[model samples]
Target: MNLKRFCTRFREMRTCYVGTQVSFLDKIFYVVDYVGAFIVHGASISDYFAYGFYKLRYNGRKEYITYRRYHIIQDKCNVLSNRCLCREKNKFNELFKNFLGRAWIDVNDVTEEQFILFCNQHPILFVKETNGYRGIGTRKIETKKQDVKQIYADLVSDKGAHYIVEEQISQIQDLAEFHPWSINTIRIVTIYDTLNDQVHIMNARLRMGNKKNSVDNFHFEGIGANINIETGIIDTVGYDTHNNTYITHPLTGKQVIGFKIPYWEDCKSFVVKVAKNIPTVRYIGWDIVIQEGGNFVLIEGNDNADHDFQQLHNCGLWKQYKSIIKYF
Candidate 1:
């Protein structure tokens, strides 16, 4: 809520919105959403008028401040609890141990010799931080690379580094055609139904990486589309991190809209099962990758899901999940 931070974030969000062609009407709606948040939280708008206003205000009623208060704090799920399950990618792999062929190892635990051996074991490997986000701390390591040792050292240097070595996931041919080199994944948002004691899929989106980035994160220079939850079909063309639009993929020229996600039912089932197992954290956003044969692998889970990504498509997640999330 610092004044400087608020001004900075306001400028950033406004800039992104303007670049994306967000209209005057939409901007006015953003103001209304901000006022609603201010009144609901029972705090002076000026107190949060800075960074908190810009960061959490516009997405939905259950945005930054509301999300932290209701989904996280009110649920008694602290930062440590969220990280133990969501932030660490390896924890998810272990949590769903039955899903075979997907493996991950921490660089700190393995010796230099073992690291090289692990690299050789897989044709293509993904080096990642156990607690990274936005695909910032990830690298693709090919076995053919000669400088594996130096790369390993740099990843595990004394600056107190933490890294995980994971196997590369292949997408189904149809999905891969959109972005072959990157592992395109489906991001499904879910909330636990306290009343019914069940988990439900609230909404879904498709994230496809461009040729420049290795991972498919919407905020990491990748393209994303809103998904039709019932039909498993992409509802729109992909948009980039900066809100730049794309109808045909820049690299492949493959049509982005109307693409159906394979193994949609199985993916939903797996996520529900996973959510049920982790009962303490009721809110979740899962990143699932569909394999070559349509079987999906769990990439990771997010407790504080980004509400803005859904809003980028000009739809609000809170509107879609109002009944399910109202109990929170």
Candidate 2:
């Protein structure tokens, strides 16, 4: 958004345009189409052309419709900082306390003695910043070896007072086979229609972390694939941030397609219920992990739901919801 950043990005856009595979006319069309979308969304031209040249293949129509332009509208609709409720992990779990088990404690509120006592109960735990994003400020705690006081002290020093000590979730074996080291999560985006007072499952994708990482965030060098909303099947193999596709997981050799998510219907139903519960926050991106026994737990929620995953699916987001999104 600043002058330096803007210049750097514009330079990158021109570089990408030089390397694009599309014809000159097609590239011109892509640029013109993006200029129009920019008028509507004010998105950076660099990102638009970069995505268009590489991923969308200079297809102006898909570039126009698929690139999300609804954030301002979403913020206007979700007037209250109800969106911020989920931004803080402690407040998120507290708001939906009935849906989750007692698996967390605020590190700031407890003494070192009490924290150790709680840690001893679980072999593994996760110390996280209550309001972190993109899997940042998260530390995996192995209770067997690490000293609780040291871990607590480091967390408090690094993240200050607002952090949480949470029990590590065990992802379902079926899903874990793709990347055993990480707890992969399903990202479901839901939109609440204020006119109808109803919620809609806009889109979803399975986000898997690399074998080396513990957190499964799309931004953390992880992979994601589209999920068939109706069938609960993954539509394609995982793709990384670079837009490189994979038919099978590089580390685990697990087949991505035809893999049906466990407790699919239950996850959908529960997310819908949660969405309806938060009336003030109409649009939400829900991250959830399926347990070993086919049950699922809500990992976190995002009110600023971007269409990055949807863009990878090679479909225009607005094509399907033109009537509703026109208001934006």
Candidate 3:
């Protein structure tokens, strides 16, 4: 790892170290185990705390996959996803137009006149960097209220970064009620088995914005609850990066647990079809927003899907994932 990332993880390890309630001897064992794992499996110090490896060893189970190991598996599975056609925002929208279900324009490609027309058509715009992750470099713009010409100029003038402006999605009213300011989305991770030619929905999570944020990204102070893949119902309490837990939405007091996602069966079929579209990228994390009348739109797909969020409740999925991906 680089110095910057190492320093950040070191700080996090220290925080977790201070907060853990284990005895002094157990703490020494934890550090030793972490060091050995870091050297052998390329695991980070934060991984030890995140997966509760300190406790898992005593329980005689070593099935948790670390952050580095997850990337290694992703790299092996996504050999062709490196092309960037599907990962980049503009190309992905153009490539998956049928599934996007929304209008979008690449600021780099459109002229000032064309941009003005797009703004007029879409009063509220969701602007994002072409390759941004974790909801960074994204914003909601009110084209009718702001200076359209200035907005267009600013977007086009940004050097070395491509931006795509999309029509704001009006989410289903039931899901929107939990966080009216943001479009709450479901993050469904899929694994395509090349040998069997089947798509498997590995895990799902309901991501909802908190503190009035416009995007429901877990990294941006949003809350995420584990969703039951079979029933499409949220089965766990909401969790955030700061270790805060919520049984109900902090803003609206809406119940998070047992909330059923609309069009559950359709969502499974839609993602399965989409997964088959790019067989080379076998593992993917798709962010979907359910619109009115039970139709869902594709927000984005992540080739390097995150593992920490889904495994936060002390359940390790290493063995299960290995069983499916071993043939590859």
Best by TM-score: 3
Model 3 clash pairs are none
Query: Among all windows of ten consecutive residues in candidate 1, which has the lowest summed lDDT?
Result: 42-51
Query: For all the candidates, what are their Cα RMSDs to the real structure?
Result: 5.2, 3.5, 2.3
| Model 2 lDDT at residue 218 | 83
Model 2 Cα shift for residue 10 (angstroms): 4.7
Give me the displacement of residue 298 in model 2, in angstroms: 0.6
Error of 3 at 141 (Å): 1.3
Q: What residue runs in model 2 are displaced by over 4 Å at the alpha carbon?
A: 2-4, 10-37, 45-68, 157-161, 319-322, 325-328
**Candidate 3 all-Cα RMSD:** 2.3
Provide the clashing-pair count of each candidate structure: 2, 0, 0
Candidate 3 lDDT (Cα, 0 to 1): 0.82
Q: Residue by residue across 19-103, what tens digits does model 1's lDDT show?
A: 4576778667656655566677532333233224445544433433334343433244323455567767667667756653477
By descending lDDT, how would the candidates be arranged?
A: 3, 2, 1
Q: Give the candidates in order of TM-score, highest first.
A: 3, 2, 1
Estimate, for each residue in 120-191, the C-alpha lDDT of model 3 and write its tens digit.
998899889998888999988898899889988998888978899999888999899888989999899888
TM-score of each: 0.80, 0.85, 0.92
Using lDDT as the measure, name the better of candidate 2 and candidate 3: 3
